[model samples]
Target: MIRLQSLTYAYRKGAPVIDGLTVDLPSDRRLAILGAQQSGKTTLVQLLAGLITPSSGSIERLARLSFPAGYQRGFRMASTLGQNITFAAKIYGADADEVIGFVADVTGLGAMVDRPLRDLSVQDRMNTSFALTYALPFDTYLFDNTFTVGEPDFRAKCLAMFEARSRTSGMIVATKFARTASQFCDCALVLIKGQATYYDNVAQGVAAYEQSLPVAQPKPAAEAPTGA
Candidate 1:
Protein backbone atom coordinates (compact mmCIF):
# COMPACT_ATOMS: atom_id res chain seq x y z
CA MET A 1 0.00 0.00 0.00
CA ILE A 2 1.05 3.57 -0.77
CA ARG A 3 -0.08 6.51 1.29
CA LEU A 4 0.26 10.20 0.67
CA GLN A 5 -0.36 12.95 3.16
CA SER A 6 -0.49 16.63 2.23
CA LEU A 7 1.64 16.14 -0.79
CA THR A 8 2.63 19.44 -2.37
CA TYR A 9 5.33 20.25 -4.89
CA ALA A 10 6.38 23.01 -7.24
CA TYR A 11 9.25 24.03 -9.44
CA ARG A 12 9.09 27.49 -7.87
CA LYS A 13 8.07 28.87 -4.55
CA GLY A 14 4.45 29.88 -3.86
CA ALA A 15 3.24 27.92 -6.85
CA PRO A 16 2.54 24.23 -6.52
CA VAL A 17 1.64 22.06 -9.48
CA ILE A 18 0.44 19.27 -7.21
CA ASP A 19 -1.28 21.05 -4.38
CA GLY A 20 -1.78 19.28 -1.10
CA LEU A 21 -2.65 16.04 -2.80
CA THR A 22 -3.31 13.19 -0.42
CA VAL A 23 -4.52 9.76 -1.39
CA ASP A 24 -4.02 6.08 -0.80
CA LEU A 25 -3.27 3.48 -3.42
CA PRO A 26 -4.55 0.02 -2.74
CA SER A 27 -2.29 -2.94 -3.28
CA ASP A 28 -2.49 -5.17 -6.35
CA ARG A 29 -4.79 -2.98 -8.44
CA ARG A 30 -4.51 -0.84 -11.53
CA LEU A 31 -5.21 2.90 -11.33
CA ALA A 32 -5.56 5.28 -14.24
CA ILE A 33 -4.71 8.95 -13.80
CA LEU A 34 -6.66 11.23 -16.14
CA GLY A 35 -5.68 14.82 -16.74
CA ALA A 36 -5.04 17.37 -19.43
CA GLN A 37 -1.55 18.42 -20.43
CA GLN A 38 0.56 20.14 -17.73
CA SER A 39 -1.75 18.88 -15.04
CA GLY A 40 1.10 17.40 -12.93
CA LYS A 41 0.54 13.76 -13.94
CA THR A 42 4.20 13.28 -14.75
CA THR A 43 5.22 15.16 -11.63
CA LEU A 44 3.09 12.88 -9.51
CA VAL A 45 4.71 9.88 -11.10
CA GLN A 46 8.16 11.32 -10.49
CA LEU A 47 7.36 11.80 -6.86
CA LEU A 48 6.14 8.24 -6.58
CA ALA A 49 9.26 6.93 -8.28
CA GLY A 50 11.46 8.79 -5.77
CA LEU A 51 13.04 10.82 -8.54
CA ILE A 52 11.78 13.98 -6.86
CA THR A 53 10.95 14.80 -3.28
CA PRO A 54 7.72 16.48 -2.40
CA SER A 55 8.20 19.95 -0.98
CA SER A 56 5.60 19.56 1.74
CA GLY A 57 4.17 16.10 2.11
CA SER A 58 4.83 12.59 3.21
CA ILE A 59 4.74 9.53 0.97
CA GLU A 60 4.90 6.07 2.49
CA ARG A 61 5.30 3.02 0.33
CA LEU A 62 5.44 -0.63 1.26
CA ALA A 63 6.86 -1.84 -2.06
CA ARG A 64 9.37 -1.05 -4.73
CA LEU A 65 8.30 1.03 -7.72
CA SER A 66 9.76 1.33 -11.20
CA PHE A 67 9.13 3.95 -13.84
CA PRO A 68 9.96 3.53 -17.53
CA ALA A 69 10.39 6.84 -19.30
CA GLY A 70 13.23 8.66 -21.04
CA TYR A 71 13.96 5.45 -22.94
CA GLN A 72 15.16 5.77 -26.50
CA ARG A 73 17.91 4.76 -28.89
CA GLY A 74 19.79 7.83 -29.95
CA PHE A 75 23.59 7.98 -29.93
CA ARG A 76 23.88 4.22 -29.54
CA MET A 77 21.35 3.51 -32.23
CA ALA A 78 23.57 0.63 -33.31
CA SER A 79 22.87 -1.45 -30.18
CA THR A 80 20.64 -4.45 -30.77
CA LEU A 81 17.14 -4.61 -29.27
CA GLY A 82 18.11 -7.69 -27.30
CA GLN A 83 21.17 -5.89 -26.01
CA ASN A 84 19.08 -3.01 -24.74
CA ILE A 85 16.73 -5.36 -22.93
CA THR A 86 19.65 -7.27 -21.50
CA PHE A 87 21.27 -4.06 -20.26
CA ALA A 88 18.15 -3.17 -18.31
CA ALA A 89 17.97 -6.66 -16.81
CA LYS A 90 21.57 -6.47 -15.72
CA ILE A 91 20.94 -3.11 -14.08
CA TYR A 92 18.12 -4.71 -12.11
CA GLY A 93 20.36 -7.66 -11.14
CA ALA A 94 18.32 -10.23 -13.10
CA ASP A 95 19.67 -13.07 -15.22
CA ALA A 96 20.30 -11.43 -18.58
CA ASP A 97 19.72 -14.47 -20.79
CA GLU A 98 16.53 -15.55 -19.07
CA VAL A 99 15.21 -12.01 -18.99
CA ILE A 100 15.89 -11.51 -22.68
CA GLY A 101 14.16 -14.78 -23.61
CA PHE A 102 11.15 -14.09 -21.42
CA VAL A 103 10.68 -10.51 -22.61
CA ALA A 104 11.20 -11.48 -26.24
CA ASP A 105 8.46 -14.05 -25.96
CA VAL A 106 6.17 -11.74 -24.03
CA THR A 107 6.71 -8.82 -26.40
CA GLY A 108 6.66 -11.00 -29.50
CA LEU A 109 9.83 -9.35 -30.73
CA GLY A 110 11.09 -12.86 -31.64
CA ALA A 111 13.61 -12.51 -34.46
CA MET A 112 13.72 -8.75 -34.11
CA VAL A 113 15.19 -9.13 -30.64
CA ASP A 114 18.71 -9.35 -32.01
CA ARG A 115 18.19 -6.41 -34.36
CA PRO A 116 19.42 -2.94 -33.46
CA LEU A 117 17.08 -0.46 -31.84
CA ARG A 118 17.50 1.87 -34.83
CA ASP A 119 16.36 -0.91 -37.14
CA LEU A 120 13.16 -1.50 -35.16
CA SER A 121 9.92 0.24 -35.98
CA VAL A 122 8.29 2.65 -33.52
CA GLN A 123 6.07 -0.20 -32.33
CA ASP A 124 9.04 -2.48 -31.89
CA ARG A 125 10.89 0.11 -29.84
CA MET A 126 7.91 0.46 -27.52
CA ASN A 127 7.64 -3.31 -27.16
CA THR A 128 11.31 -3.58 -26.26
CA SER A 129 11.06 -0.80 -23.72
CA PHE A 130 8.02 -2.30 -22.02
CA ALA A 131 9.48 -5.77 -22.03
CA LEU A 132 12.62 -4.50 -20.41
CA THR A 133 10.68 -2.78 -17.62
CA TYR A 134 8.18 -5.59 -17.10
CA ALA A 135 10.92 -8.17 -16.87
CA LEU A 136 12.14 -6.52 -13.67
CA PRO A 137 10.46 -7.57 -10.42
CA PHE A 138 9.15 -4.21 -9.30
CA ASP A 139 6.22 -4.12 -6.90
CA THR A 140 4.64 -1.06 -8.52
CA TYR A 141 4.77 0.22 -12.11
CA LEU A 142 4.09 3.75 -13.27
CA PHE A 143 3.48 4.31 -16.96
CA ASP A 144 3.06 7.75 -18.49
CA ASN A 145 1.38 7.33 -21.86
CA THR A 146 4.11 4.92 -22.93
CA PHE A 147 1.76 2.21 -24.21
CA THR A 148 0.11 4.56 -26.71
CA VAL A 149 3.29 5.07 -28.72
CA GLY A 150 2.83 1.98 -30.87
CA GLU A 151 0.54 0.45 -33.47
CA PRO A 152 -2.93 -0.73 -32.46
CA ASP A 153 -2.02 -4.42 -32.35
CA PHE A 154 1.19 -3.77 -30.46
CA ARG A 155 -0.60 -1.41 -28.13
CA ALA A 156 -3.05 -4.17 -27.34
CA LYS A 157 -0.15 -6.43 -26.40
CA CYS A 158 1.33 -3.74 -24.18
CA LEU A 159 -2.00 -3.34 -22.41
CA ALA A 160 -2.10 -7.09 -21.90
CA MET A 161 1.37 -6.97 -20.42
CA PHE A 162 0.31 -4.31 -17.95
CA GLU A 163 -2.78 -6.30 -17.01
CA ALA A 164 -0.66 -9.32 -16.28
CA ARG A 165 1.63 -7.25 -14.06
CA SER A 166 -1.30 -5.79 -12.12
CA ARG A 167 -2.37 -9.27 -11.13
CA THR A 168 0.46 -9.41 -8.60
CA SER A 169 1.52 -5.79 -8.22
CA GLY A 170 0.08 -2.31 -8.26
CA MET A 171 0.04 -0.05 -11.33
CA ILE A 172 -0.60 3.62 -11.88
CA VAL A 173 -0.91 4.74 -15.48
CA ALA A 174 -1.36 8.29 -16.69
CA THR A 175 -3.03 8.73 -20.06
CA LYS A 176 -5.24 11.10 -21.98
CA PHE A 177 -7.00 8.16 -23.64
CA ALA A 178 -10.25 7.47 -21.83
CA ARG A 179 -10.86 4.27 -23.75
CA THR A 180 -7.56 2.87 -22.59
CA ALA A 181 -8.32 3.75 -19.00
CA SER A 182 -11.86 2.44 -19.17
CA GLN A 183 -10.72 -0.87 -20.58
CA PHE A 184 -7.81 -1.50 -18.22
CA CYS A 185 -8.10 0.42 -14.97
CA ASP A 186 -10.18 -0.62 -11.99
CA CYS A 187 -10.14 2.91 -10.56
CA ALA A 188 -9.56 6.41 -11.94
CA LEU A 189 -8.23 9.70 -10.62
CA VAL A 190 -9.22 12.84 -12.47
CA LEU A 191 -6.92 15.81 -12.16
CA ILE A 192 -8.32 19.17 -13.14
CA LYS A 193 -6.81 22.58 -12.51
CA GLY A 194 -4.36 21.19 -9.94
CA GLN A 195 -6.94 19.27 -7.98
CA ALA A 196 -7.17 15.50 -7.88
CA THR A 197 -10.47 13.71 -7.56
CA TYR A 198 -10.64 9.97 -7.10
CA TYR A 199 -13.29 7.80 -8.70
CA ASP A 200 -14.25 4.33 -7.63
CA ASN A 201 -14.96 3.35 -11.22
CA VAL A 202 -13.43 4.32 -14.55
CA ALA A 203 -16.75 4.71 -16.36
CA GLN A 204 -17.94 7.32 -13.90
CA GLY A 205 -14.70 9.22 -14.22
CA VAL A 206 -14.92 9.15 -18.03
CA ALA A 207 -18.48 10.38 -17.91
CA ALA A 208 -17.52 13.19 -15.57
CA TYR A 209 -14.64 14.15 -17.81
CA GLU A 210 -16.84 14.23 -20.91
CA GLN A 211 -19.36 16.38 -19.14
CA SER A 212 -16.67 18.83 -18.11
CA LEU A 213 -15.70 19.62 -21.69
CA PRO A 214 -16.95 22.90 -23.09
CA VAL A 215 -20.00 22.44 -25.29
CA ALA A 216 -19.26 23.31 -28.91
CA GLN A 217 -21.26 26.21 -30.21
CA PRO A 218 -23.32 25.36 -33.26
CA LYS A 219 -22.45 27.36 -36.34
CA PRO A 220 -25.23 29.65 -37.42
CA ALA A 221 -26.65 28.84 -40.87
CA ALA A 222 -25.23 31.16 -43.49
CA GLU A 223 -27.85 33.80 -44.31
CA ALA A 224 -27.83 37.14 -46.13
CA PRO A 225 -28.50 40.02 -43.79
CA THR A 226 -32.14 40.96 -44.14
CA GLY A 227 -32.15 43.99 -46.45
CA ALA A 228 -30.47 46.12 -43.77
Candidate 2:
Protein backbone atom coordinates (compact mmCIF):
# COMPACT_ATOMS: atom_id res chain seq x y z
CA MET A 1 0.00 0.00 0.00
CA ILE A 2 0.99 3.62 -0.56
CA ARG A 3 -0.21 6.45 1.67
CA LEU A 4 0.15 10.19 1.42
CA GLN A 5 -0.55 12.47 4.38
CA SER A 6 -0.95 16.22 4.03
CA LEU A 7 1.27 16.11 0.98
CA THR A 8 2.07 19.43 -0.61
CA TYR A 9 4.52 20.33 -3.37
CA ALA A 10 5.41 23.30 -5.49
CA TYR A 11 8.11 24.34 -7.92
CA ARG A 12 8.44 27.71 -6.21
CA LYS A 13 7.26 29.20 -2.94
CA GLY A 14 3.73 30.76 -2.85
CA ALA A 15 2.63 28.71 -5.84
CA PRO A 16 1.80 25.14 -4.89
CA VAL A 17 0.93 22.42 -7.33
CA ILE A 18 -0.31 19.87 -4.83
CA ASP A 19 -1.76 21.13 -1.56
CA GLY A 20 -2.31 18.98 1.48
CA LEU A 21 -3.18 15.90 -0.55
CA THR A 22 -3.91 12.67 1.25
CA VAL A 23 -4.74 9.27 -0.16
CA ASP A 24 -4.03 5.60 0.38
CA LEU A 25 -3.57 3.19 -2.49
CA PRO A 26 -3.61 -0.53 -1.89
CA SER A 27 -1.95 -3.30 -3.86
CA ASP A 28 -3.47 -5.55 -6.54
CA ARG A 29 -5.80 -2.91 -7.92
CA ARG A 30 -5.74 -0.65 -10.97
CA LEU A 31 -6.03 3.04 -9.98
CA ALA A 32 -6.32 5.88 -12.46
CA ILE A 33 -5.32 9.51 -11.90
CA LEU A 34 -7.04 12.16 -14.01
CA GLY A 35 -6.19 15.81 -14.29
CA ALA A 36 -5.76 18.65 -16.71
CA GLN A 37 -2.35 19.82 -17.82
CA GLN A 38 -0.22 21.39 -15.03
CA SER A 39 -2.66 20.07 -12.45
CA GLY A 40 0.10 18.15 -10.64
CA LYS A 41 -0.68 14.74 -12.08
CA THR A 42 2.94 14.03 -13.01
CA THR A 43 4.16 15.45 -9.75
CA LEU A 44 1.78 13.19 -7.81
CA VAL A 45 2.93 10.18 -9.83
CA GLN A 46 6.57 10.98 -9.07
CA LEU A 47 5.83 11.42 -5.38
CA LEU A 48 3.94 8.13 -5.29
CA ALA A 49 6.91 6.42 -6.96
CA GLY A 50 9.28 8.14 -4.49
CA LEU A 51 11.06 9.95 -7.32
CA ILE A 52 10.48 13.35 -5.78
CA THR A 53 9.91 14.40 -2.18
CA PRO A 54 6.89 16.34 -1.02
CA SER A 55 7.53 19.84 0.18
CA SER A 56 5.72 19.59 3.53
CA GLY A 57 4.17 16.19 3.99
CA SER A 58 4.83 12.47 4.09
CA ILE A 59 4.58 9.47 1.81
CA GLU A 60 4.60 5.92 3.15
CA ARG A 61 5.21 3.04 0.79
CA LEU A 62 4.64 -0.56 1.86
CA ALA A 63 5.08 -2.34 -1.43
CA ARG A 64 7.67 -2.71 -4.16
CA LEU A 65 7.05 0.09 -6.67
CA SER A 66 8.20 0.51 -10.24
CA PHE A 67 9.10 3.81 -11.78
CA PRO A 68 6.50 5.33 -14.05
CA ALA A 69 7.20 3.38 -17.24
CA GLY A 70 7.57 6.36 -19.56
CA TYR A 71 9.79 8.41 -17.26
CA GLN A 72 13.54 8.00 -17.78
CA ARG A 73 15.17 7.02 -14.52
CA GLY A 74 17.89 4.36 -14.21
CA PHE A 75 19.32 4.50 -17.72
CA ARG A 76 22.61 5.91 -18.92
CA MET A 77 22.75 7.41 -22.38
CA ALA A 78 26.32 6.15 -22.78
CA SER A 79 25.40 2.60 -21.76
CA THR A 80 24.11 -0.11 -24.02
CA LEU A 81 20.57 -1.39 -23.50
CA GLY A 82 21.94 -4.73 -22.41
CA GLN A 83 24.20 -3.10 -19.82
CA ASN A 84 21.40 -1.06 -18.28
CA ILE A 85 19.16 -4.10 -18.17
CA THR A 86 21.89 -6.07 -16.46
CA PHE A 87 22.45 -3.35 -13.88
CA ALA A 88 18.74 -3.06 -13.11
CA ALA A 89 18.41 -6.81 -12.67
CA LYS A 90 21.45 -6.91 -10.39
CA ILE A 91 20.07 -4.17 -8.15
CA TYR A 92 16.70 -5.91 -8.01
CA GLY A 93 18.22 -9.34 -7.36
CA ALA A 94 16.69 -10.70 -10.55
CA ASP A 95 18.39 -13.00 -13.03
CA ALA A 96 20.28 -10.70 -15.39
CA ASP A 97 20.36 -13.10 -18.31
CA GLU A 98 16.65 -13.78 -18.17
CA VAL A 99 15.74 -10.11 -17.81
CA ILE A 100 18.07 -9.05 -20.61
CA GLY A 101 16.74 -11.75 -22.92
CA PHE A 102 13.14 -10.87 -22.11
CA VAL A 103 13.68 -7.15 -22.74
CA ALA A 104 15.49 -7.81 -26.00
CA ASP A 105 12.69 -10.03 -27.24
CA VAL A 106 9.95 -7.66 -26.13
CA THR A 107 11.58 -4.53 -27.59
CA GLY A 108 12.50 -6.32 -30.83
CA LEU A 109 15.49 -4.00 -31.12
CA GLY A 110 17.41 -6.90 -32.64
CA ALA A 111 21.13 -6.14 -33.08
CA MET A 112 20.68 -2.61 -31.74
CA VAL A 113 20.30 -3.86 -28.17
CA ASP A 114 24.07 -3.65 -27.75
CA ARG A 115 24.23 -0.09 -29.09
CA PRO A 116 24.38 3.01 -26.91
CA LEU A 117 21.02 4.63 -26.01
CA ARG A 118 22.25 7.91 -27.51
CA ASP A 119 22.14 6.30 -30.96
CA LEU A 120 18.49 5.34 -30.68
CA SER A 121 15.52 7.49 -31.71
CA VAL A 122 12.99 8.74 -29.16
CA GLN A 123 10.46 6.04 -30.01
CA ASP A 124 13.14 3.39 -29.86
CA ARG A 125 14.27 4.66 -26.47
CA MET A 126 10.71 4.52 -25.15
CA ASN A 127 10.26 1.00 -26.50
CA THR A 128 13.51 -0.15 -24.96
CA SER A 129 12.69 1.44 -21.59
CA PHE A 130 9.18 0.03 -21.59
CA ALA A 131 10.49 -3.47 -22.21
CA LEU A 132 13.18 -3.09 -19.59
CA THR A 133 10.68 -2.08 -16.89
CA TYR A 134 8.40 -4.95 -17.77
CA ALA A 135 11.31 -7.34 -17.45
CA LEU A 136 11.80 -6.41 -13.80
CA PRO A 137 9.46 -7.68 -11.08
CA PHE A 138 7.47 -5.29 -8.89
CA ASP A 139 4.22 -5.28 -6.91
CA THR A 140 2.83 -2.17 -8.58
CA TYR A 141 3.60 -0.55 -11.93
CA LEU A 142 3.21 3.20 -12.39
CA PHE A 143 2.55 4.55 -15.85
CA ASP A 144 2.19 8.18 -16.89
CA ASN A 145 0.39 7.34 -20.04
CA THR A 146 0.44 3.75 -21.22
CA PHE A 147 -0.70 4.65 -24.74
CA THR A 148 2.14 7.08 -25.34
CA VAL A 149 4.84 4.39 -25.56
CA GLY A 150 4.50 2.94 -29.08
CA GLU A 151 2.77 2.68 -32.41
CA PRO A 152 -0.68 1.18 -32.89
CA ASP A 153 0.38 -2.46 -33.07
CA PHE A 154 3.04 -1.93 -30.44
CA ARG A 155 0.56 -0.23 -28.13
CA ALA A 156 -1.72 -3.22 -28.64
CA LYS A 157 1.19 -5.43 -27.72
CA CYS A 158 1.74 -3.42 -24.56
CA LEU A 159 -1.94 -3.68 -23.74
CA ALA A 160 -1.71 -7.44 -24.02
CA MET A 161 1.35 -7.45 -21.84
CA PHE A 162 -0.40 -5.42 -19.13
CA GLU A 163 -3.52 -7.55 -19.42
CA ALA A 164 -1.42 -10.55 -18.49
CA ARG A 165 0.40 -8.79 -15.70
CA SER A 166 -2.74 -7.21 -14.22
CA ARG A 167 -3.81 -10.61 -12.99
CA THR A 168 -0.91 -10.62 -10.55
CA SER A 169 0.34 -7.04 -10.20
CA GLY A 170 -1.31 -3.78 -9.22
CA MET A 171 -1.15 -0.61 -11.39
CA ILE A 172 -1.39 3.15 -11.00
CA VAL A 173 -1.99 4.90 -14.31
CA ALA A 174 -2.14 8.68 -14.76
CA THR A 175 -3.64 9.67 -18.07
CA LYS A 176 -5.91 12.01 -20.04
CA PHE A 177 -7.28 9.05 -21.93
CA ALA A 178 -10.73 8.36 -20.54
CA ARG A 179 -11.08 5.17 -22.54
CA THR A 180 -7.91 3.74 -21.04
CA ALA A 181 -9.01 4.59 -17.50
CA SER A 182 -12.45 3.09 -17.95
CA GLN A 183 -11.12 -0.04 -19.52
CA PHE A 184 -8.25 -0.77 -17.13
CA CYS A 185 -9.07 0.89 -13.82
CA ASP A 186 -11.63 -0.01 -11.18
CA CYS A 187 -11.11 3.19 -9.14
CA ALA A 188 -10.02 6.72 -9.97
CA LEU A 189 -8.78 10.02 -8.56
CA VAL A 190 -9.48 13.37 -10.17
CA LEU A 191 -6.93 16.06 -9.44
CA ILE A 192 -8.08 19.65 -9.56
CA LYS A 193 -7.43 22.95 -7.78
CA GLY A 194 -4.63 21.30 -5.79
CA GLN A 195 -7.09 18.77 -4.45
CA ALA A 196 -7.99 15.18 -5.25
CA THR A 197 -11.40 13.55 -5.45
CA TYR A 198 -11.61 9.82 -5.13
CA TYR A 199 -14.27 7.77 -6.84
CA ASP A 200 -15.08 4.11 -6.79
CA ASN A 201 -16.23 4.22 -10.40
CA VAL A 202 -13.89 5.40 -13.14
CA ALA A 203 -16.75 6.95 -15.09
CA GLN A 204 -17.81 8.96 -12.05
CA GLY A 205 -14.29 10.26 -11.70
CA VAL A 206 -14.29 11.31 -15.34
CA ALA A 207 -17.57 13.12 -14.79
CA ALA A 208 -16.18 14.88 -11.75
CA TYR A 209 -13.12 15.92 -13.72
CA GLU A 210 -15.33 17.39 -16.42
CA GLN A 211 -17.38 19.19 -13.83
CA SER A 212 -14.34 20.58 -12.10
CA LEU A 213 -13.05 22.25 -15.25
CA PRO A 214 -12.92 26.03 -15.04
CA VAL A 215 -15.81 27.59 -16.86
CA ALA A 216 -15.17 30.47 -19.20
CA GLN A 217 -16.92 33.66 -18.12
CA PRO A 218 -19.15 35.39 -20.65
CA LYS A 219 -18.07 38.76 -21.94
CA PRO A 220 -20.13 41.68 -20.68
CA ALA A 221 -22.42 43.17 -23.33
CA ALA A 222 -21.82 46.83 -24.14
CA GLU A 223 -24.80 49.14 -23.61
CA ALA A 224 -25.71 52.55 -25.07
CA PRO A 225 -23.53 55.26 -23.49
CA THR A 226 -25.39 56.52 -20.37
CA GLY A 227 -28.75 55.90 -22.08
CA ALA A 228 -28.00 58.88 -24.35
In model 1, the number of clashes is 0
What lDDT tens digits, residue by residue, belong to model 1 across residues 18-71?
A: 999888875467788888788888888888878789999889987778764434
> Candidate 2: misplaced stretches above 4 Å?
214-228
For residues 165-217, what per-residue lDDT tens digits would candidate 2 score against the true structure?
77899988988767778888988988887999788788899888878777989
Worst 10 residues of 2 by lDDT: 145-154
Worst 10 residues of 1 by lDDT: 67-76
Model 1 clash pairs are none
Candidate 1 local Cα displacement, residue 210, angstroms:
3.5
RMSD (Å) per prediction:
3.5, 4.3
The TM-scores of all predictions, comma-separated, are: 0.78, 0.88
On a 0 to 1 TM-score scale, where does candidate 1 land against the true structure?
A: 0.78
Off by over 4 Å in 1: 69-83, 106-123, 146-148, 223-228
